[model samples]
Target: MRGVPGRLRPRSLRTRLVLIATVLATAAVLVCQATGLTLMRSWLIGQVDDRLTDFRPPSPVFRDIADGTAPVRRPPPHEALPSDFRVYFYDAEGRLLPDSLGSGRSEPRLARTIGDGLPEDGRPATVPAEDGDGDWRVVADPGPDGMRAVVALPLDSVRDATSRLLWFSLAVGAVTAAGVVLLGGAAVSLGLRPLTRVEHTARSITSGELEQNVADTSPDTEVGRLGLAFNTMLDQLRAALHRKDRTERGLRRFMADAGHELRTPLTSLQGFAELLLHDPHMSRSRRREAHELIAQNADRMSRLVDSLFLLAKLGDAPTTEHGPVDLLSLAADGIAASAVRHPARRVTLAPLTAGGVGDSGELDVVEGRGDPHQLAQVLSNLLDNACTHTPPGARLQVRVGSLRAGPRTGGTERPGRTGANPPLPSGTPVHVVEVADDGPGLSPQDAQQVFDRFYRAPPAAGVSGDSGSGLGLAIASTIAEAHGGRLELDTGPGEGCTFRLLLPAGRP
Candidate 1:
């Protein structure tokens, strides 16, 4: 993090959180300050008003003045004046009496809004000055004559105190807000430590260290949940990467095998062509053999190339353009073809009706939707595999039909098992076409990898001619999978192999 560039680093979630907390703290501080200022002002003014009402002027002053025996004694200036207190008297004509000190200077006319207001007995009212500096709260009482005695408090001291309080509040609020921001930022950073770890883990992953995972913490909290999800995602990524690595390895091996297969035919063709070119005195039979060798090698290379192309096409998810294919017809045709190709072998087609039968009978029909061309290829490959692995006169049969799902007399089967499929959901039906031969069956290990490209087991006795590229079953498997079906192998050593092609039944 110290060496990381600013623009590339992730934005801080902590800063935003701290800012919001500080703003809220500031608002709370402001509210408390305002309330405190308001209450202080009110309480001070109430004290001033009480003082004005309770403090009696010299006892004979009011009566003597009314009797015209003596002049009124003004309230002492030091007791009230400098502290922002003063006195006033207004006659019936609303003229201020001369001795009244309503203003520090002598030009004493009251503002009209304040002059017209009469004080209620217990309440004092504030009057404002036009200069925007000092203001007054006035309390009025009845004098001996048709006159009103009013006491005025300047409100300057209260204003001064509040002004000082405001500044003090601001200082304290500033300190508190700073503290909140600092402490909150620290707390947030600590709280977000898991996210930081997640970030570090991500960086390590990008740097090719995929094993790094966020350390486990509390599951009930937000960051903990995020860490959990992050680790899960990492696990998925690692698994996908592992699969990719395996696929690449498989791809390399496949290419190596394909190259080896092609090289043999190419080498033979080259040698034969070279021999024909170099031999000027070659016999007719020898020359003919050379040409035959060329053609044969060419054929071998062509088949291998064609098989490769077909496997590639299957990988591309070639379109099915499916229609109902007759499994019985397909089996019969494959068996007939195999019979012609290996006349020494006995290949037969049998059909099972409602219940499975041991012997051939009237052919039964079952249908599924798939590309017939591809399906035929699947059947042909199974027949060919059986022929290559079995004895010269081995017994081979192709059977096709439908079977009801659910509640079989015996346990149902999975791939590599010589039994029926697990009973389909109740009332369902499955169409199956199978090729079984009396050749040596496969061991469990071989059966598992039998569908892999270019695999070859030991050839049977008297098996001659070009051994296949081993792509037949692999291509067949791909085709079956693409059709939403499966090509399953049921074979074990000495018992022979049965390839069951199970397909979803076409709608009636």
Candidate 2:
């Protein structure tokens, strides 16, 4: 008994729904059956009472009595009564008349208990049978001379009819309840098919099938909406996992590249130091050359370490300071520096015209918000990469301007310069600085990974200069992203390269 509640408790949604539906249906059936039985019994008893009250004698004696004529002093002849019925007579003193009783059948003898306190009024009532067989419907009819006649109808037929009906209703109710359980279970299971699919998809994902997705993602019903939401969540999770994997791969590659870059300079420095320490008697000029080589390697190592540290800092906190900066001025400065560093290269700076083309227009201060120092580094890196990688006498031009950057649509021209696609509402004003060079550009493979740390394009023929650390373009790109901007490249083999720096345009 202690475990009965636990056993009856519905553990699943399907069970609970079917159980509740079946119970309600059963209750409804019981209530209807009970009401029907009560009404049927009342109607049947009413029918019995009517028959008893409507009874009449066939020998003219009852008609005479009903007409207020006194009954003969002697008892009337015993006439046969109707089916399942009996009749009796009483005197003015309430005494049973001799030989007055008659019945349609035998075995169910009328009890004396019924005649002892008979009703004087003309109404119907119930009385018991002598053999304890059943109850009877009794009615008393008054006559002249303080006399009355009594009639009784046995209730066996009414009981039998009601009993049979009760059994039939019980059988039907039981069948209906069973049908409710079976059909209700089937309907509930059908409704939960989407949930079942979701469960299967979840299990598949848990078992390392990352691409598994629910198939019933319609947006109409509640279950459909649930499936749609689950599918959406799964897609997002899959994308997040992919991004995580990519990030981890990039980190590992960065570390390996950093170690390799540092190892080269460290090896050179160690060799030079060992030579200087072990060969103390070497010529003074050779010793001085060794010292210079050591200094050069040390400086290279220092630059590599500084670039790695800067990249790390950017990763942690991309931008530490912000201020208004003029891209036009920054470009001019970078061109001047590039001209000084690579005297043979033709470097120039110009402003872009309002028509989305570069020209000899008067320089306009294309301003943006960022750390001036970092922005300067980005411009310097672009100029250096252009001048150092391109052939000697390559024309390197820097163009700076402000324009509304629109959504990317796979166009060759820069944003706001394309006529094929319209701009989106998210278009914003940005200062674009283009460092373009007419030199043998990189191949498609090299151009794709130009912004990756330690990635370098093969130098053009007759192009000889300090390649410096490969972190220049990578650092520039990082700084641009940190400032809520981006650095893009357009190039192909022999088409020349254009490194475009786009930054948000603002003064505050």
Candidate 3:
């Protein structure tokens, strides 16, 4: 047999509301019914007690016969006792007296024993008995001549009344519960109407309607508070959308300017190439000049295109990778390469002693599962940036070390000391790399925007213009994020800037 498909079944709000209301109403009705039944039972018992008190024998002759002072004989006519009741007389010898009116069945032995013990003051005593049909209550009182008078009342009438009352009350409670459920469902739906409106409004906003706001004019209630919160969220969303739009427009304009820059170089290269091709008979010095012009412009255009491609790739690269990387080695290689590329700049490395999770002298070598190439690119970008912005012969310091941080600590130990205690163990490691320059640093405002793409600081006084593609720091930041690390800059006007890269140094 095929199995049934598993799917979520949504419950109707109306039905749920109705069911809840019905449960509450049923509980209340049951409480009321129980109380009513208790009082009704008490009232019925009192009525039965009063009837027993007021019972009397039929006549003087019948009373005499019941007392056993007269012989068995026919008695005078007498009115009947109440419905469900019967009268019987028995003598002191336990024989049926002549005035008895019920069927000829013998009196119960318990009823006779009760009659015999009746007080002379005529106080009635009640005893249980059964008529030919069902159970009855028998009350016995002594007469003046040693005879006893007994009256019996059937219980069927009271039982029938109680049963009818119970059924009727149940019917009424069920009807009331149904009414409450219906009305309660409608009320709940009306109460939730504002939430429905808010949901629709949010959907509309998500479908490109940025100016929409939730309705906030309702009375002060939970729905009103919800509406107010929704309106505030829309306001924040609007501001975010505006910022995103501005960024997109700025990016378009930047691309246009870059395109113009590339086009100018290409146009110059093409014009010079055509001139050299058509003027093969020209002088050697003129030909050499034309070729140099073409080559220089072509080289410049290639560099610009390469920078643009690098920035685009950085922006679009995936942020997750799965492979172990040696961060320490990567940083060392990047610093050495950048120093070689910028021969005039001075680059220095400070060795870090690892002392935590592992005992290795280096902090677990800052091993992590990531893309090494991307990490190297990030380091290269930071280094290139430091070289380009700082003055010639400026000292660039790169330091790597481990520190104690985070919630847990573990690892091996490495033997070393800066001053007093040996270096920390390996497992308890937090890797950090700081790249500082002793050149003119950025102002506070410039430092804040330095990591933003296409942002460059104002020209420094008494120095040649900066040579940069303006995306180096931004690309570095993107790479840091991919490795679950952060790139932070510390700088102020006239105080050199230090760029720090902090990452966890352990197995991920």
Using TM-score as the measure, which candidate wins?
A: 1
Off by over 4 Å in 3: 1-240, 243-247, 274-282, 352-369, 404-430, 459-466
- lDDT by residue (1-508, candidate 1, tens digit) is 7666876644767876888889899889989998999999889888877877775444355555445566555554454445444666555555565555433532222533325656664467777754655777777766665656667766777889989999999998999899998899889898878788888878988998889888855699887888888888989998999999999999999999999999999999989888988987999999998888899889989999999999998888664578878777888788788878877888877875456656757776676778999999989988888887777776888887776533341114444463222333444566778788877778887876788889997776766765688999888888877776667777788888878777767443
Better TM-score candidate (2, 3): 2
Please give, for residues 423-487, the per-residue lDDT of candidate 2 as tens digits: 22345666788888888887777876778789877778997766878999888888877887767
Superposition-based RMSD of candidate 3 using all C-alpha atoms, in angstroms: 12.1
Greater-TM-score candidate between 1 and 2: 1
Estimate candidate 1's alpha-carbon lDDT, on a 0 to 1 scale: 0.74
Listed in order, each prediction's TM-score against the native is: 0.81, 0.74, 0.50
Clashes of each: 0, 0, 31
**What shift in Å separates residue 71 of candidate 2 from its native position after superposition?**
12
Model 1 ranges off by over 4 Å:
1-11, 46-69, 72-85, 90-97, 101-134, 139-150, 217-219, 352-357, 360-362, 404-428, 506-508
Residue pairs clashing in model 1 are none
Candidates in order: C-alpha RMSD to true structure: 5.3, 6.0, 12.1
lDDT (10s digit) by residue, model 3, range 1-508? 2333323332776566778778888878878887887788667755765686588765675655644586444233354333444667766565554455544333432433434453234443444444444345556676555666767655556667777888978997889888887788788888778878888998998898879888754557887888888888888888898999998997897787687777878899889888888888989999999889888888877877786776677568745465877767887899889868987777877655433221234333656556788777778887888777877766787766666532222121212101011223343445666677877888766776787766777665544644565667777777766565556776677778777665555537
